[model samples]
Target: MAGNFKMLAKTFYGFEPILAKELRDLGAGHVKEGVRNVTFEGDTGFMYKANLCLRTALKIFKPIATFKVLNEKELYQNVNRINWPKYFDCGKTFAIDTTMHSDVFNNSLFVSQKVKDALVDKFRAVERQRPNVNTHDPDVRINVHLYKNFCSVSLDSSGSSLHQRGYRIATNIAPINEVLAAGLLLSSGWDGETDFMDPMCGSGTFLIEAGMIACNIPANINRENYAFMHWNDYDDELHNKIVDASLNKTREFHYKIIGYDKAPSAVRKAQENVDNANLSEYISIERKDFFRTEKPIDAKLHMVFNPPYGERLQIDVEDFYSKIGDTLKQQYPDTNAWLITSNLEALKYVGLRPSRKIKTYNGKLESRLVKYEMYAGSKKAKFNPDGQEAKS
Candidate 1:
């Protein structure tokens, strides 16, 4: 606890609690869940581990300064007070990202511009040289957040986004984000206890993420870049040590992790991604129509997928959803099926009541992650006299 400091992990709307649990499990202190983010205390090594191990985090930030401001001048002065030269060199390009929810500052762009000016001004006054702004792809990313009259400035430790896990070299037309896929799998209570599946896998995002989770593998193990790596005080030896320590924590996965995509191209891409992640040993990708296929094995299966919502793929909504319902009820016995879709009206045509319905968002559209429990033989007779689920 000598050098432990507060850090924040940014996540999706319904994933704060999951991220908080991840932080706590990773030995973080003072873990607290906030809206779309989780705050915790850790040292520099812990920061590296958090960025590498956290599955649901989009970005990890280290707060540098916090102050109260009412206007642009106050914001500029407060930002300028920080020692910018100590964080990154002037040779490295930097970018400022500002998010504001205040009456005084109405425009986020204006706020970012002011902050950028302050940073460049301070560097020029002290070092006589300014770090050029690289909005496209900056080596250093600075985060500015304003709530009411309070402003907090932090260094974005993770560049781009943690969802770019580096294993997914190939992708389909409408591929699900890696972080969202991982969050959905975690939300569905997948623990590698049973056979896992994604009937509508696109580019194998869910399958790879599922395999990684099932094996206790780090989320960003394949990733080679981070904003912190570009900082002046970055410790390569400590980072490598953390990486090795995290890798040593991985456990074996016995059950199968399978994926299905009807499209031939999707199957190839998914297989390519699975191999890229070195998860081919634990996962299988096949080109098969899910509606025409039954469960691969005679065991309880954990299923999660994101089917078309009648928006992109031209298909009959009613017929497709009805077929999905019929297949699960008639073929997939002793299984827990979960799917997320924005087509709420189409979801009703499935004709099966969801055991659990959770409100979630997919990118910008509102969606629901619903679960359907398929019994072995009959709903009332879930267990036979032998205390086992009756199989047809």
Candidate 2:
């Protein structure tokens, strides 16, 4: 507890509780949930572990300093007082990102500029040379969040977004974010309990993430770097030990994880990504239109996918949705299918009343994760096409 510091893990909206649960499970102390973020206590080593292991976190930030500032001068002074030399060297590159909800700082760029100036000034004063600022790819990334009069300065432990899982080399036009993919799968209560399928598997994110969850694999086992590796106090041996320990905890998964994509390119990309993630043993990708393929496995199948939303892909939204519904209703019996889309108007064409519909945001678009339950065998079922019960 002596070295433990408060940390925040940023996430998407409606994912705070899920992230909090993850932090608590990973032995974080005093875990608390905020809007689109979760705060917890951990040490430097745990920071590295969190960056490596957390599946739902977009970024992990370690707050180095907090202060009260009413104006720009105070902001600069507060940031300058920190011991910058203790964090990185003058030869290292750095970048600053700022977010503010305060009236004092009108522009986030100005705040970032001030923080950068303070850091460069400190380095110049001590070593006579400042760390070069590299906004594109920095050795160190700093985050400043100003709310009202409170300013919090944090070092970004995850250099890039955790969504860059190091496995996805090929992507389709509208590939889903890895964090969102993992979160959506978890939200659907997918613990690899049974056979899993992604009917419209683009890039196979869901299939790979599901395999990792099923096997208890570390989320970033394939990732080669983290921002903490550049820190002065980073312990390579300790980090390696943590990696070994996390890998040792991996469990056996005995269920089938399959993916199908209509586009041949998508299937190729998905297969390539699955191989890159080292999950080829657990997953299989096929080039077949979901509407034309029948259920491969007879056992209970859990499905999650994002079809062409008509936003970019030129397709008849209503007819495509109707075909999806027809495929599920006629072919995919004994399955719980879940899909997410921003096209609310076209959702009606699905025909089946969603058992559950939850409003969520995918980036700036308002989206819904809807679920439909198709019972197994001999059970007479009918889809309501009157469009009466489908609620937003």
Query: Residue 215 of model 2: what lDDT?
Result: 94
Identify the runs in model 2 with alpha carbons over 4 angstroms from their true place.
378-392
lDDT of 1 by residue, 1-392 (tens): 23999999999989988899999999999999999999999999999999999999999999999999999999999999999999999999999998889878999999999999999999999999999999999999999999999999999999889999999999888899999999999999999889998999989998999999999999999998999999998999999999999999999998999899899999999999999999999999889999988888888899999999987777899999999998888778888999999999988999899999988889988999999999765323356788897754
- What are the per-residue Cα lDDT tens digits for candidate 2 across 111-208? 99999898888888888988898999999999999999999999998999998989999999988999998888888889988999998898899999
* Pairs with steric clashes in candidate 1: none
**Per-model C-alpha RMSD:** 3.2, 4.5
lDDT of 1 at 67: 95
Give all TM-scores, in the order shown: 0.95, 0.95
Once fitted onto the true fold, the runs of candidate 1 whose alpha carbons sit more than 4 angstroms away are 378-392
Model 1: lDDT equals 0.93
lDDT values, one for every candidate: 0.93, 0.90
Question: What's the TM for model 1?
Answer: 0.95
